[model samples]
Target: MPLYAPSPALRGRQLAADVGLLAWLVLWVVVARTVHGAVLALAGPGRAVEDLGASVAGSMSSAAQAAADVPVVGDELAAPFEALGSAGGSVGGAGQAAQDAVGTLATVLAVVLVVLPVGWLLLRWLPWRLGWVRDAGVARRLATADPALLAARALATAPLTRLAALPPGTAEAWRAGDPTATRALAAVELARLGLPADTLGRDERRLGLR
Candidate 1:
């Protein structure tokens, strides 16, 4: 048997739900991509960081070179001055590498923490919001149930707030543990589902309650 037989209205609702879900996914991904790009732009090879490193290194190299010119010690200081230039180059290279690492980490974090989680949560929850699958499943389960079983199931599963649409005292009576009130509430709801009262004893017999 097919898992569900959804009405045309239900199918239409499902289609709209699908379109909305797709739109949301695309919009979310685009926004995430834009934010990711912005983060990379700010962190990657930016002039501020690169220039800071280069400027510091150049200043150090120039100072060291100028200091190496004392007549008596000039030859003796040449090696130290050259070492300073090498250290300056190392510093510049290290700073650039650090910036690159930071940018790469930001990209990874954005995808892991933001993009993946949003996609997962939306995918998991959005389908349930489609009434066709959900209502069809509920309807199928209730189709073979007896009146009392239907009432019992409704009491267990239906939201209490939904009872407000029934006769005035329905919610109050059900909340007060009145079996009659519960059955009446179920009757109204099941009627809307096109089921007649006690149409089958399958559910009650299975539950061993009748």
Candidate 2:
């Protein structure tokens, strides 16, 4: 037997879901890279400078230890210790600097993880609610929809390219799906959008789309 395929509606919905996931993943990657770069830059003089300072301090301590073990240069090693002690004065400053850098990284990551999704949702939902503000830059013909119909449009979020030339009412009924009123409203809407009246069935037409 041949494998069964989903209907066009099911396939379209799945494709939409996949696109949303891909967009979110791309956003997260960009955010992560940005946060990492900021933390590194704010570390001031970068990781290389901090590592160099630590290496120099460690080498000086090792040299002093060697000198003291040899007995003859014990006083010379004491001099080296004083020099190291002076260098260590900036240790606290470096730590504070690193802490501040890390804090900024945390803040940025928090915004990307927490705030960005909320913002995307608002942008996604809000325009559909308020018709005047939605992005309608494209010259595509949109269904002249009331608020509920508009809400359904936003919820569906179909790609403009994939949308078939639907009778607006049938599309709205499919979206809203109130069995009591759906067929009736769909009939009127189909007539309004110039679709065939038979599309909603004879029983639906007899029952006024109240």
Candidate 3:
């Protein structure tokens, strides 16, 4: 299958468009990564809170141990410190939960940021590129297999202005199997596809028609 137009100008444009699309995808990926990092930065405070809670829990646990060594009030004194330690542990859990939530948000937002615009562009661009490849392949085969078919396609699909620009009686002559008119019409169709008009001439020579 033909991947690009035979014409130098059209081929160059296709190449440029492909390169641009690659660049666009790379740019968006970089942007998504940057945004993800920025969002993840918000977790710094959560980490600080977790550390503070852990520090408090450890200190309270140590104090409770020390308090248990007291005489009569030892058990009662240790109870309050144990309660404080439990509260600190709850704070640490809350901090961890906040960090998890932030991490999830960062991932989701980054995915959305990359998917929407990139997917939309692909939806619009892929069909046209694929269509060109299909049409060009068909045109290439038909150019050799049946120049008359290409002539007929030109008569049916070429703009009226272009049709009129052809020599007078060109369409009527093509229908009458006039070689000149058939070649002319075929050239028109080939030009529209950015194929060389000489493709028809080569086929004619191979068939001993020239």
Go through the candidates in order and give each one's C-alpha lDDT.
0.61, 0.49, 0.87
> After superposition on all CA atoms, how large is the RMSD of candidate 2?
11.8
Clashes of 3: 0
Off by over 4 Å in 1: 1-5, 44-78, 101-105, 112-127, 130-135, 145-148, 151-210
Ranking by lDDT: 3, 1, 2
Total backbone collisions, model 1: 0
Predicted structure with the largest lDDT when compared to the true one: 3
Candidate 1 is scored at a TM of 0.48
C-alpha root-mean-square deviation, candidate 1: 8.3
Candidate topping TM-score = 3
lDDT per residue as tens, model 2, 41-120: 66665454566656667767776676778777787766776588457535634755676777677677856764677567
Residue-by-residue lDDT tens digits, candidate 1, 1-210: 232223455445556766776776777667767777777766555445566667766776776677677688875666676676677667677767777876887678667655676677677656665443455446546644444545666656666666556578766776675656756766655544444545433564554434
lDDT of 2: 0.49
**Residue 150 lDDT, candidate 3, scale 0-100:** 91
Q: Tens digit of lDDT per residue, candidate 3, span 47-151?
A: 888888998899999999999999999999999999999899988988999999999999999899889888988887788789888887787788777888999
Candidate order by TM-score, decreasing, is 3, 1, 2
**lDDT of candidate 1 vs native?**
0.61
Candidate 2 residue 186 Cα shift, in angstroms, is: 7.8
- In candidate 2, the residue pairs with backbone N, CA or C atoms under 3 Å apart (3 or more residues apart, or in different chains) clash, namely 184-209
